[model samples]
Target: MPSVDPAASSMYTNQAYNTTRTTDATSMDKNGFLRMLTAQMSNQDPTSGQDPNQYFQTISMMTEVEQMTNVATSQTAQLSRQKDTNAQAMLGHQVSYITQDPTTGASSTATGTVASVQFDDTKGPSLTMADGKTLVDPDSVTSIQ
Candidate 1:
């Protein structure tokens, strides 16, 4: 059996194995935590086992990550509401947008007064034209008169 250096073993870090970095490098999500934990378990020195303190710290960190994700999700929902409110204020104001035909995949410009705004978590904010039937994306608006 090969001998292991105790100090080197204790000093092992996730950085050594994490060869790639993504746009969200500043964050360690739940999945990231799990991957790191799995790696640690797989690579640990079998004779010494894991430090109990480190295990507890990992659990604490996971809780912190869960809280952070909740807060971020809440903030996003709040911002979406704000955007919907702003879109609602545009009701009765003239707006123009590009329309696409589902069958032909052709685009055309249409102009009408904003009649209503719909807030959807999946679709964000959408506008209903004064025509009472035409639906448009706020982002599709080319001009506001």
Candidate 2:
């Protein structure tokens, strides 16, 4: 009986998986670029140093990344504050909301005045019913009076 070699089969599979593959560029933040620059400086050949233009280009990229990060952070905080203001207006208003139990697949609707609002990093804003039940989905409000 003839035997199949495991090493030969593995080589064939690897070649099939890697065939015709083109490398895609991965995104790097400012910190990653800085680390890369540090490594490049430390490893450069003493006879011929790295180009000054490349160093300046890396600094420019880092500055742009920092500015973009600051803008994104400011915009996020502004949106959060707007949501909180809107939710605050719901307090003391009679509202109806729907809730579903995940395990039982049962649903129910409750009516009450909004007792308070809850805030977290992830959710937009949660509403606490007068009965103490909290609703996370703001759109689930069926009626607001």
Clashes of each: 0, 0
Model 1 lDDT per residue over 43-79, tens place = 9999997889989997997888789867876776667
lDDT to native, each model: 0.76, 0.72
- TM-score (all chains, Cα) for each model: 0.57, 0.60
Give the Å shift of residue 44 in candidate 1.
17
lDDT of 1 at 77: 60
Query: Once superposed on the true structure, which residue ranges of model 2 sit more than 4 Å away at CA?
Result: 1-29, 101-110, 121-124, 134-136
> 65-111, model 2: which lDDT tens digit per residue?
79987787677667666766777788999988788999998989877
Tell me, by lDDT, which candidate is best. 1
Error of 1 at 47 (Å): 14
lDDT score, candidate 2: 0.72
**Stretches of candidate 1 above 4 Å error?**
1-52, 120-122
TM-score (C-alpha, index-matched) for candidate 2: 0.60
